[model samples]
Target: MIRVVLAEDQAMVRGAFAQLLDLQPDVTVVATAGDGDEALAAVAEHRPDVLLTDIEMPGRTGLDVAQELQGEQTRVLIITTFARSGYLRRAMDAGVAGYVLKDAPIAELVSALRRVHAGERVVAPELAMAAWDSADPLTPRERELLQEVTTGASNADIAVRLNLAEGTVRNYLSTAMAKLGARNRSEAANTARERGWL
Candidate 1:
């Protein structure tokens, strides 16, 4: 049997995936997690063959988990609603075995999981092509500042949370806005998110 660890923030989605995946004769839902941290814990405990997760969730994002698990035995497969090429590119860089949209049919998702387990890369054709169109321009610090900007947090607040100077936060935001060709902080955040940079 193919052991699987399904991770999604939404309880209903997690339960549904668990139930549906469990019904597959060749697959077993070894564990289900509601957040990235829990998903990592589950993977460590179960040593599943696949980690199927959404991009965004509480704690670390799925991309973060994938980055941490690179070179491990378990394969990572992202199942998310975000179709932005930037996210896909980041997933590929993190060594994720597959990237499948949440709207894909369950059968296709299962196929992707199996393929990923078999060491084959899987991604939507268009997305795989688009992922190379333009690389993400912002650095990690810039991305973090922009993410906080989207939350409507002040530079001072973000500074305190990130343990950076308020001036540093402002500078990062400015750099991110310039790189994204955004007119303002809000616009910068929106542009980054639209491009899946944030």
Candidate 2:
């Protein structure tokens, strides 16, 4: 049997996935977790063959878990509502076995999981194409600043949060805006978001 651990923040979704996978003849739901930390612990405890997780959760992201477990025994499969190019690119960079949208048919999800368990790469075609079409232009620090800006934080607020000088925050914003060809920080944020770069 293919022992699997499922992790998602939504209780209903987690239970539904577990029930469906458990009914499969060749797949077994060995464990379930509500967040990344719990999922990691469950993996350590069960040492399952596959991990199916959501991209965003309260504790940590599926990307974070995949990066930590890459090259390990358990293969990672990301099942997320987000189909953004940035998320797809990051997942591929982390070497996840599969990345599929939550809106995909149940049959597709099951097939992808089986494929991932068999050591095959599975990615949604549209998301892969989007990843190829768009690229993340911001540096790590610039991305960080943009994330802060998206939260409606001002330069002073961001400076205090990042512990950088207000001038430095403004510079980072300016550089990011220039790179994105945006007229202002809001425009930069919108551009980055549309390209899934944020």
Best model number under TM-score: 2
Residue 91, model 2: Cα distance from true site in angstroms? 0.7
RMSD for each model, in Å, please? 2.1, 2.0
> Tens digits of per-residue lDDT for model 1 on 134-187?
788889889888889888999899999999999988888888888888899999
Query: Per-residue lDDT for 32 in model 2?
Result: 96
TM-score of 2: 0.89
Candidate 2 lDDT over residue span 72-103, tens digit each? 99999999888799988888888899999999
lDDT of each model, Cα atoms only? 0.91, 0.91
Give the TM-scores of the predictions, in the order they appear.
0.88, 0.89
